[model samples]
Target: MAVMDDSRLAEELRLTIGRLVRTVRAVDTMPPGEAAVLGYLDRGGPLTTAEIAQQRGVSHQSAAKTVKGLLTQGLVRVEAHPDDGRKLLLTLTPAGHDRLAEERRRRADRLGRAINAVLTPDERKTLEAALPLLSRLSTHGTGE
Candidate 1:
């Protein structure tokens, strides 16, 4: 059999993943950046504005703006950092936790429904089996 064109395969995978992400994100209450910052905090624990910005691959000002929105929504709050009164820490408020949880549920449900409705049982199984390969592909260039 002829070898598959790596470029074509890469392009197809990139577009497919992008569309899938966009579709899931469309149902989310929070915008992508805000949701991402919230997610990083939720999983990685509280952090400073600069830390959040670094982890999210955005500028300090951009992260601050997103944080400000979260604050306005009462989703996150700033408090004095322990062991360092000079610095402030950002953490999710009770409302923030609730909002993130709901957003995640909605996105997962939307994607799950689409997969179940669109893919046959065998196809779903095939996709499930490809998870490891897909994950490897996703992290291929990363030093993780």
Candidate 2:
């Protein structure tokens, strides 16, 4: 194996991951922002638009626009916050659940096919071994 410094490894990881994400995302049927909103709602929702913006690391305006599109598509529903009457919370609709599931299935299929096609058995093992580390790195990515 070629020697790599920390910075070099970081750069390589960042670039390769970025490209891979783009490749996987290319198969998505919905816009990324909308898909993201659905995912957030699925995971930790009944969230206000401001909370969504904070979680997504976007401006309130951007998050609101995404919410609007989701609402229009019937993927998300808004309701009054339990504690705060003035604030509204968003929840994923049944359609939203199905849509999010489909989106995940499509991306997983795309990535799984590519992984099988491109990697040898040993390489596959190595990649699987790296998954935990990658997950940790991802967690640290959220300003943790």
User: Among all windows of ten consecutive residues in candidate 2, which has the lowest summed lDDT?
Assistant: 135-144
Clash-forming residue pairs, model 1:
none
What TM-score, to 2 decimals, does candidate 2 have? Answer: 0.94
Predicted candidate 1 versus true structure: per-residue lDDT over 11-109, tens digit per residue: 888898999998988898768899988898899888999999999899999999999999899999999999889889999999989999999999999
Best-fitting candidate, scored by TM-score? 2
RMSD of each: 1.8, 1.4
Q: Please report, in order, the local distance difference test score of every candidate based on alpha carbons.
A: 0.91, 0.95
State the displacement of the C-alpha of residue 31, model 2, in Å, after optimal TM-score superposition: 0.8
Each prediction's TM-score versus the true structure: 0.89, 0.94
**Position 79, candidate 2: lDDT:** 92
What is the overall TM-score of model 1 with all chains considered together?
Answer: 0.89
